[model samples]
Target: MRKLTLLFSILLVSLVSAQTLQDSITFNPQQQLNAAQRILSGNYGKAVTVGAYGEVTYNQPEALNGELDIQRLVLLFGYKFNEKTQFVTEVEFEHVQEVFIEQAFVNYNVAPNVNLRGGLMLVPFGIINEFHEPTTFNGVERPSVDNVIVPTTWREIGFGVSGKLNNLSLGYQAYVFNGFQSTSFDGEGGVNGVLKGSNGLRSGRQKAIQSTIDSPTLSMKLDYYGISGLRLGLSGYFGDTQAEDDVEEIDGANIGISMIGLDARYAYQRFTARGQYVHGSLSGTEDYNNLTGKDLGSELQGWYLEAAYNLLPQEKTQRLFAFARYEQYDTHAGTDGALARNDAYNRNDLTTGLSYHLAPGVVLKGDYQFRDNAVSGGEVANRLNFGIGVWF
Candidate 1:
């Protein structure tokens, strides 16, 4: 912890010094022109930043294969060459030792209303779908409904555009990247049960894995804040995903997804009201020609809705804030099309939480969640969680 604090202090000093130099350079009109000339002459501006967070939870099903773990961390660094171009990336260490590159992307701002960004980037969707900060949203944790259906932080090697016009902001992304893999034919369980295989371009596993596949995906989101203390947004995504197997030609085994999301928030002084709704669909045909006339597995679909209210009394001078959120989800909203076959899988979740703002860039939070897997023939369980979050 002392080392971390020392590193943070050094970073703070660097940022302050850079800001001071920039201000001084821009103070004079001629210096400003010279600065522009220097940039046009290939001079580059850069920055180094850091961020971290942690979470711990306790659950009632600790003895039933569900142990509450105190594990979760994410760090990021970013740099910019000019006002029109930049790069940002993050590395997430979950479960303590498992490290993965969460995101890495280069952005070019072509115009105030248009940008051409490539590399891996968050699939722009509803509010917290991309940047999953605890305080940025209302819940103690992300909505379970959004997690499985829309898949938060869902990103792939893709390009997209984002900008604002008047009170409306729009963003879009599309890519061709590795898709999800199914470990079991039954289709609904653990994270390993939904594991995704790496692309062949990275390793030789491509030749031995027949179930490896790549999917085409796209997402779009729009945000509008036309009224004071009120902001609203919507997002949607579509994709055709599949898995390949050499033993069986699982042709036309493509998946199609459709999502509709809505969010509204009102903030005045210390009081805030927010709510969100995301509806999604997952469908595909199970065809294995090499399996000798074998076509099994069922189509999937799900949706969920959530709401929260933040109570912050005015006239307070402490560095603290409190909030609570209520969430609910349904794995099968409507059993139409080919989704009726998977009607046996359904779940619901409810959560409530509180948060404290210890400083301008730090937050402490705690919450309780109740989940019911109605189809798993299991009883409902309660979970308690607490964590500290930070960003810079």
Candidate 2:
């Protein structure tokens, strides 16, 4: 009896120590070195780290059959070479069939506030493009503006520098990356263009799969969080699209692009709010449209605003938040050549949802979306969505 009691006491003490250690570690997502530094500072002397995040969703559109899908499953792998260098990668599976390399990068800390990174990296555009973990946002589906305008999950092969100023509570990133491919040769003496009026540059993403580069693009972002509960971001991208070697000399093979974005997020007690605006201007669209027989737009714009309130007490480990968002986007905000603006490309969405945080890295979400377009006599297809998300 005494031996068993002693063993129980030892186990209890060890468990208490582990719990204490875990409770003492705190992380700030707004910090530039949050991910890499967390691993190096924690991990209990381990050099290798593994993590994952995923989401499963069900959608039911009005007058349409419901569909259930494993929207995304991503596995994270990281290796800490030393105090100053680390490698991180995320492998993603979409819809249970398609596989993608979402992010693969090497970060080298050169100074206390500066780091250099390279490889396939997410573009630091709007909020969702860079901070897209499933549990990080409230809605079951991402804001439509992020999808249609900012083009979430947009990443490219690049090298750049990122750092934060502790005193100023500011972060910055700047990189030179391979731009989108506007037109590519099909190898059968035919040419195909990916840019269109409906989705702007979304379909032009090469995703680093044998990506070709005709011109290097400049992308940069600045974030400020000096205010207690507010964060602001400004981003910009400028470049010309790439074309296949065969089409490089063509009159309208590529287009020049300039995009800018602004976003803000705030949290005060149990209330939170966020907003974003993105605008893009395309040059040479008239010539490209005539040559490719496509209706590509000259200007694209989108914006969204959201607010949420937590319903649960702060002392509890779980939380429930009710949120509402409004989004507006226009892919054909302007047109060039003989092309006319398409009212159907001007869209808006109103979404209201509840996100239940069952634990720190797990959540259940439900939302209703009223979707519409500017086209005359167009029918609206509202949707109901439910989803489960997890991150670890």
Candidate 3:
């Protein structure tokens, strides 16, 4: 695989170089975009960018309890198809155990006013839903609400459009993908019972939970960036998730999710302020009776807010930044019937950290966090973490 990748890279470089030579012989500012595409050999220049991030988190369940562990590595790559089209990918490795491709998509610019993308793309549900980077956020970590309910970096198969009018940027996307499955509905109990510990619920099977060829999900997003360095967005999704020929006879799951987000930064004289908020709910039927019977749905919800400041200004070469964040979520909100009865359903986390720049595209960071589990008998969790991140 590595050899094949290297060969492809070399071929692409050769093509790009040839095109660049031709473009130099016939250069025109008015036709720069077209020239770039031609030089790229197709529509865009054969360009590639790569990035990676790694983190380790420690949390103590209580003052006396030992720390729990959380860690991950995230990598991203993009291929420019032109000014109008690109291919992007994101992969994640959890606990240094295994790697999974989180996102892989092709984006096409239909017009200056419209665009379309498909493949395994982010679900476009909430503000931080699509781009949840640890260093990018204000706090030591993302919000609890985002993790449990809105589910950041959530993706499915779909397509949509985005563009600019005047000073405002407008965008939207619709996709057909898998929806959430209920634990109680399929004898899985709840996310808390099934995913964290026992795996009784059929929902435990993330690999099995996918959109069938016959039925696909739909999701969309609307975003604006008219204000200098300020971004505002809202998104929603509705979908059906059901298994075929299952013993439970569960018909399908219905879900409605929504979120609003705001972000801004002023990089004058080496100072910056950035923040984002996202809230959403998950509702649908679960196989409770183990007989394909539907039950009252649960409300899963969460949100996060953060802020950051750069300690050393105008020293991009010697990077130094400080940030903090608070996040919370409840997986079993307002559910009537269940084996757990909302117990072990709530989580709150607070994090603060500092980062140092190792190079133009590299960084090292360390942080500490405090966690609370309202449902887990008020257990308190805390931990320290450090890691590295880079982009090229």
Best by TM-score: 2
Ranking the candidates on TM-score from highest down gives 2, 1, 3
Worst 10 residues of 1 by lDDT: 196-205
lDDT of 2: 0.84
The alpha-carbon lDDT assigned to residue 126 of candidate 1 equals 62
In the range 185-251, model 3's lDDT, one tens digit per residue, is 3346422112221111223223323643324556666656555445555666564443333422433
- In the range 1-392, model 1's lDDT, one tens digit per residue, is 69557856865775554431222111111122221112222223445433444555444443355456655666555556678876766666677667666667777879866667776666666655554654355445666655655566565556667656753433333343444443223434211123211110011112112335565556677767566666677776666554444311344334455667777656665565666777665454333212212222232234444434334444433334455555555544544333233323356666667767655445677777776665556766577766666543
In model 1, which runs have C-alpha deviations exceeding 4 angstroms?
1-46, 58-70, 167-215, 244-249, 286-312, 315-323, 334-344, 373-378
What total of clashing residue pairs does each candidate reach? 1, 0, 25
TM-score of each: 0.70, 0.91, 0.69
lDDT of 2 by residue, 1-392 (tens): 69546844754554444321122211133432223244444446456665667999999999999999999988666677888888877778899788799888898989998999999988899888877776778899988888989898899999999988879888899999999999977678767888998899999999999999988999999999998778899999999999888797888899999999999988876788899999999999999998788899999999999999889986677879999999999999989878999999999999999999888778999999999999899988999999999876
Global lDDT of each candidate: 0.50, 0.84, 0.50
Tell me the TM-score of model 3. 0.69
TM-score-best of 1 and 3: 1
TM-score of 1: 0.70
